[model samples]
Target: MKTNVYGDFACYYDLLGWSRFSKICAQRLKNFVRFRGKGDETILDLACGTGELEYRLRKTKLRFVGVDMSRRMLKQARGKNKGVKFIHGDMTSVRLKRRFNIVVSFFDSVNHLGSIAALCKMFKTARIHLREGGFFIFDMLSPEGLAGWELVEIRRKPGYTLIINGFYFPERTLAEITIEGFVNVSSGDSSGKTTYKHFLQKIYERSYPLDKVAESLTKAGFGNISVSSFDPDEPIENASRWFFVVS
Candidate 1:
């Protein structure tokens, strides 16, 4: 099995408060799907990190199938969710040979595709998996969003201490986040000494302007596109992230 970028970090994803955001996203997704869903809908989630969204929607009527490139992340997802199918694959090229009533990629996972060309390929992949008139809803970090994340912060918890540093290169439209930490992996021995494990990870994301994003979706053969802020109904301007609903 390939140890992807998420590797060790997968163990602490929810502990780091990342999963908390899934609650709001799940509700938004439920609302969007309920408006058009026929109560027996199937959803395809690309880059479905740790299946947090599924956990948030466990009571809903939709059936979810998740795909992610990180094997470690999928392991965490599979261990936590029941009856939901999880697959290992890259969103830019993976195919299931079946269509879904709705396709979603949340938490700016599309930004990891690295470039506009890769983003276009991901869009095409979503279209291929979507049934006719089905919607592809996703979100991306805006340039403003990336800029806001350019900071260094230290967090201390019960068993771990984490140092996070964020950097943004406007010239390259790239954002890099480095997470360095030590976790107390073992209880104290008779000598009252604890075992600590050190881990380091770097995550890279890229942002594009609205026009370029729309052009790529159009190139992917989508005729209808909706752009908004995180709310999915508010106008897009200076927000942390933007949502795209393309069909």
Candidate 2:
């Protein structure tokens, strides 16, 4: 079996305080689906970390499927949601023969792609699997969100020690986070500690602008492209995260 890089970290992933944000984002996504989705039974949650959104959406009438690259994250998601199918796969290249009425990637997950080409590839894949009138909804961090943010180190203890350090580059609209720490394990006579480090470099890509995203959608053969705040009812300028609803 392949070792999951985030498996050990998955146990304490929620301790980082992303659960609350995921809940809010999931609700927003659900609302969007309710209004614009074609009442299809299937929905895809791309980059569905730890299956939080999948678990929440299970209460609804729709059937949900989740895909993520982290095996550990999928493991946790499977434990929480046995009925919802969870697949360990890259978001950029998912090959599901069936199509979906709504495909959502939330919580700044799109930022992980790191480049315009990767982002365009993801859009292409979404277009490939989306139904005729289906919607692809995803969020990206705005450049405004990165402004004035400085590198900081923070430590959290929830079982093991986790040290999170972040640095932001305004010029590039990018932020890199380095998590370095130890996982404490108990043995018969003494305690043991193993060191681990993970790096996540995220690009805000806000410089692309909403018009550019629409153009990409058009290039991907999607029409009726719409960009708005996360609320869907709010103006685009007010949203820290851009929500693209493309058909």
Candidate 3:
């Protein structure tokens, strides 16, 4: 999820700026399957935020379902997509009644795992939710990327402003994001606007080494595990992000 909508964060999730490229990402995933001469229809979007990818993929022939830990995020997603299905639960431990051809967690959702054990557990869940030879795809932050992350950025729009601060804790190999935001909530005309709402939220993320992640997936019984740089055509290199594909 781009922004967790639990607690008071939901009030500003949509207000916080986010880049949109769900259609492109969805096409890449489908092309990946087609390149391998495989059929990918049903999909489960782990940590699907606000149903962006789901909305995009729904245009295709694929079936879509989403799961997340934040109910408020799911609520907003439901508001946008009336008939789509969404489950509110922990991604690492949630149980579903059915399986899917492709299980994907995009936008570095795997980084949200507090520990390698949690990541392995989520991988196990993905494996169990898939049929024979089904695909499990996800992305995560590279250590080099984390090391190079800028500490602060300020974003301003017409009705909202967001300030983001981040730091890495070497002791725990964890990254923290602290955000403070201001949103104009005044009623009536823009000229008469006077009310301003302020909110704050903190988020923490962690990532493991490539070998550890691979070992964990292997132990989880995933086969044909391979990770590549942001560009799937090339090898795993110095890219800021990585994409993992396994069956």
Candidate 4:
């Protein structure tokens, strides 16, 4: 599975104004774990782009391992976190040698699974790598939520200028985004440019209803399955930006 979502944006990911929200989300997960008295448990951060959540865990003195497909993202993560381990791997297929007490994928990372089959594979893999009574927590976009958003094109700049456009198909519960960008360079009174275009397809995934997610968890052998908004305690609702916490 190729990931155009992070391929070019990996470097500017943190600069996109998500750090504060990322920290809040990570802390919410931490609070959930602490409330359950699951302290000092091994944690896995799947699709941990730039290891932002891992960094949050690090501050709490918890052991964490982060996995992402983008080497550039991992590189940035490594620069900030010398203690937490980072791996270059896909979320759906990578296998860790040991099971974890808690597995987390944030920021709609599970949405990147791209298909129902892939999403099921991820649930199965997480179940396999999770200890008995362990938890698997992640997020996905609500179909309605995707439809409410506008598909707009925008440009970002540095040495590079990125153009992003998006299309949302409600019937299929899928969104296709196309990104085209240029990298500019100047040396010795000379200038040059390189352009790249990438396409990414993300399913709205609302078909797998919250109950179905809980059912999948039960099928995967996770006991006491729980589904809630990102708030952790709130009721699951269509308005929620994230559906998480399965254990």
Best by TM-score: 1
Candidate 2: 10-residue stretch with minimal lDDT: 198-207
lDDT of 4 at 8: 54
The Cα error of candidate 4 at residue 151, in Å, is: 1.5
Please provide, for model 1 over 65-88, each residue's C-alpha lDDT reduced to its tens digit, 9 standing for 90 to 100.
Answer: 999998988988998898899999
Could you give me the TM-score of model 1 versus the true structure?
A: 0.93
Superposed model 2: Cα runs more than 4 Å off: 1-7, 37-40, 147-149, 153-162, 180-207, 231-235
Query: lDDT by residue for model 3 over 197-245, one digit each (tens)?
Result: 8888877778778889899999889979877897656456776778888
TM values, all candidates: 0.93, 0.79, 0.89, 0.80
Residue 194 in candidate 1, Cα distance off native in Å: 2.8
Query: Which prediction has the highest lDDT against the true structure?
Result: 1
Clashes in predicted model 1:
0
lDDT, candidate 4, equals 0.69
Where is the poorest 10-residue window by lDDT in model 4?
Answer: 198-207
Q: Which portions of model 1 miss their true places by more than 4 Å?
A: 1-4, 188-192, 231-235
Ten-residue region with minimum lDDT total, candidate 3: 1-10
lDDT of 3 at 172: 69
lDDT string for model 4 (3-117, tens) is: 4446555655666443556787677777877897457888888888888777776767568888888798898899888978999888878998899988888776776666677
Clashing pairs for model 4 are none
lDDT of the candidates, in the order given: 0.87, 0.69, 0.77, 0.69
lDDT of 2 by residue, 104-216 (tens): 88877776776666778878878888877777878776665544244565655544555556667776666665565554444435445454444332223223556666677
